[model samples]
Target: MKLTASAKLVYNFTGPTEVIGLIQASHSGDQTILSEELILSPDAALVEDEDVRGDRRFRTCLSTETSIVYTATVDNGMRSLLPRSGRQHLWNELPPEALAYLLPSRFCPSDSFQRFAQREFGSAGDGVSRVMSILEWIAAEVDYVAGVSTPESSAAHTFTVRAGVCRDFTHLGITFCRALSIPARAVSAYSLDVQPPDFHAVMEVYLENAWWLVDPTRLAPIEGIIRIAHGRDAADTAFLTTDKACTVVSQTVQVSRVDTAS
Candidate 1:
């Protein structure tokens, strides 16, 4: 499916501030890009780099207040297929690139949840079934409350509170998957047709030699999701990161589907 997406962030600076942002769509095997427009007011020198884990990063130093506007139009053909039963990847057969996701991370402490995961999902039929069970449990147990979780909130906190936004749900899912020895990572994306449209967060679990997308919030269709960044947790995939002091004056994100048959 084809979609158009944009994000605008207005910042007020008391002094010079350096910023690093990861808000551009990732050019992956499944998504085809048609066009993209990015602008920084009072333009400064911008540098782009890809991290070791394949996350794209953009950096700029701002001496004056500015607005960051990013717009993109792309076709997303990556749709979630029906979960395959009895499909699982053993530890010895897994690829080296997927090893990091199986370990604990900043927001997702998979090591601490081993007992809980095994007790709750150990009897599941297969890896995919356990992941489905985890998704269902989170969807039913967690309350989707906005502004309740802070940037420092971790999977353990969300698990205890049993309430959080999409990011929390994703972290919990990733944590559970990793605790059970399944590789999982957090995914940032522009989700078309999601209510209260905004930049959305979901997750992907590696199973049967492929990463499969899963939305714990179940708020958006899998086909309408366009990935921007992939990371172990929210810390690595944040839309904006800064080394200097700055206050957010205003922020807005918009996403919509465009009909081509007009």
Candidate 2:
């Protein structure tokens, strides 16, 4: 599938502030970046870096006010549908890198949810079955209320309130997966179907020696998700981070499907 994604951000910085932005689609084996453009108002110098996990980061300094615009067209060739069944690796069998996702993080306190996860999903079997069960439970139990959660909300908080947006949903899913000893991480992406057209949050789980994308909110199809960045939790995948306090003046995001021949 071909997808076109874009974002516009306007901010006011009270003082000199360092900013890191992660709003670009990832360059990976499964996706081909056919065309892209990034514009910074007032033409400030920018530094680009790619992390070990392939997440691209753009660093720049802002004073007074600034605006950022990024747009990209990509051909995502990877399969969107996950397999019905896959073997769940025991902790001892997981690869070294996958081990990190099986632990707790700032927003995904997997350590605190072990007993709850086991009691709720212990009989869900393993691998994809367990993952599907978790998604179903979240869908059935949680309410997708937008203003009910804040940046500091964690999986435990969401579990307590049974309400949150995509970020909270992903955090809760990751926490539950890790609590069950399945490696899972948070994913930030652009999806064609997200209401209000904003950056979307999802989860990726390690199964059958690979990471599979899962959207607990079920707002967007997996095939239409264009991954931007992924990490232990929302703390790592945030679109914008500033060294000093900054006010968001305005922001907009849009994603749509493009004709393959176009």
Candidate 3:
């Protein structure tokens, strides 16, 4: 199966920003279940337009702007895809073993987070039932409201307070997975179904033999869904950043999932 997606974020900064830098992971990652024969572009020139990833790493410098746009297209294999229950676990990075090392930035999976996960999820190791329980509780706890929370919110904060947007939910969920020793990371990108000029977040849990997308914000698992990029946290995949302060006044985005030939 082939999936193509587009994402754009419009920023209305209160003040001018200098040297806008963007770190995007919108490229579709290659997985045992899904082979990324062609990812549009990992990085590209900054414009009020579309972007994609090529085979290699892409980088660019953006002029100070309030809004940023990102995008991706992925060729996914339909068969050989693993079920949620069969996702692989990292025994080597189990909490006991990983606690000593902090997980590298969102780019490299961390050992510290794994150790934290191991300690919490050891009881329910390799059990989809257990993982589902954790996800459900989180969805129920977190409030899906944009502009209400910032990236600073921690996993423990969202879990204990239960009030945040998709980013916070994803952060909390991914952190919990790490705390339990399951390889997990936060996904920041765009969702077609939702209004664009906006951002979305999800959790990618390394389970069974592959990574699966879980949207705690929507309280559902996203399989065969389009992905823009991924990283340790929202900071890693921020679409827009400014040197000075700014306030967004208005923004708009449109996204859709299109099917292509195999």
Candidate 1 per-residue lDDT, tens place, 1-262, comes to 8889999988977777788989888887778779998898878789998766455779988877799999999898656563766466888889998999999999999999999999998688788999998988998899999888998999999999999999999999999999999999999999977777778999999987788888899998888888899989999889999887788888888888868896
Which candidate leads in TM-score?
2
Candidate 3 yields a Cα-based lDDT of: 0.52
Best first by TM-score, ranked: 2, 1, 3
TM-score of each: 0.96, 0.97, 0.65
Candidate 2 residue runs with Cα over 4 Å from true position: none
Error of 2 at 113 (Å): 1.2
- Tens-place lDDT per residue, model 2, 129-248, is 989999999999999999999999999999999999999999999999999999999999999889989999998999998889999999998889888999999999999999999999
- Clash pairs of candidate 1? none
Instruction: Give one clash count per candidate, in the order shown.
Output: 0, 0, 34
TM-score, candidate 1, is 0.96
- Relative to the true structure, candidate 3 has a C-alpha RMSD (angstroms) of 6.8
